[model samples]
Target: MATEGIEAVFLTTHNWGKAAKFFQALGYELDFETDHNSGQLRNGDGPYVFISEIPEDQETQTQIVLKVPDADAFRADSPVEVVTPFEDTHYGTKEMTVRDPDGRLWNLQAPGKN
Candidate 1:
């Protein structure tokens, strides 16, 4: 299972307001917002980016969204230490991640490309 050029969305900003405006200027529309200071920005079709503010309790974190063909299968087969198990996301995708050797997490997102 493999993703067909999945858009690797990332959270690079600490301010959601500024980030939203910037992406909007760049043509990305604000689709939805998550409770945990996270939100999604969609451009056209695929590769919608997800942005989340740094939690006050948790230090700033950055995530790399990797496209997996079959998120469920990939999660079951992955060798890395799983942080968040693959499950149905609010934006309609199966996502999972593992903290890398350096503690950085790689977010694997597999939207239903069907």
Candidate 2:
């Protein structure tokens, strides 16, 4: 149930191209890109940066994605308040969200098989 460390930073932006360019200027290499203007970038061995186009109705926000050893076990043993139950993601990761005391949302993720 231990966390390895911060996995990625998820950013919702109105202009994905601009956001991606900004990160690229900062030396982030594009790892993957999708047709919807969503992609992942990496800088050397550091944590990844995931960028996605924000929906019209949603506000732009930044979310930190943490990598846990076992998301399922972490959720079951976590003392923090769960904001979302653990669920498998389309990217082949099991993820869940928990709210901090200050009401900040933290997303936890662990690698999973398809």
Candidate 3:
């Protein structure tokens, strides 16, 4: 199945406050913040940015989230290597992880089943 394109970008930062402020300065507005040091931001109609805080010892990284209309269908027809099966997320969505040819991990997100 073909992907619907990028849904969002997941980013990890050592300092949530500073990272959020940096994005804000870049014109991305905070959409909502979680109880944990994480939030979603957006600029225009483009894909949103989801940022989360990580321990200083851990290296921050960015991963692209691709949109799939149905995770089950995608799993059955996908050509890439599925690193992990789709699972329901606390934020309300079904997510699966895939590994690219370069060994980078990418996330596939689909609407939750009704």
Weakest lDDT window of 10 consecutive positions for candidate 2: 69-78
Model 1 lDDT at residue 18: 82
Candidate 2 lDDT score at position 3? 77
lDDT head-to-head 2 vs 3, winner = 3
TM-score of each: 0.60, 0.90, 0.92
Please count the clashing residue pairs in each candidate, in the order shown.
Answer: 2, 0, 0
> On residues 34-97, what C-alpha lDDT tens digit does candidate 1 reach at each position?
7766688999997888788875566655566877777656645655788978878765888877
Runs in model 3 with CA error above 4 Å?
75-77
Model 2 / residue 82 / CA error / Å: 1.1
lDDT values for all models = 0.75, 0.88, 0.91
Best by TM-score: 3
By TM-score: ranked, best first: 3, 2, 1
Error of 2 at 18 (Å): 1.1
How good is model 3 by TM-score? 0.92
lDDT of 3 by residue, 10-57 (tens): 999998889999999999999999888999999999999999999989
Answer with 1 or 2, whichever has the higher lDDT.
Answer: 2
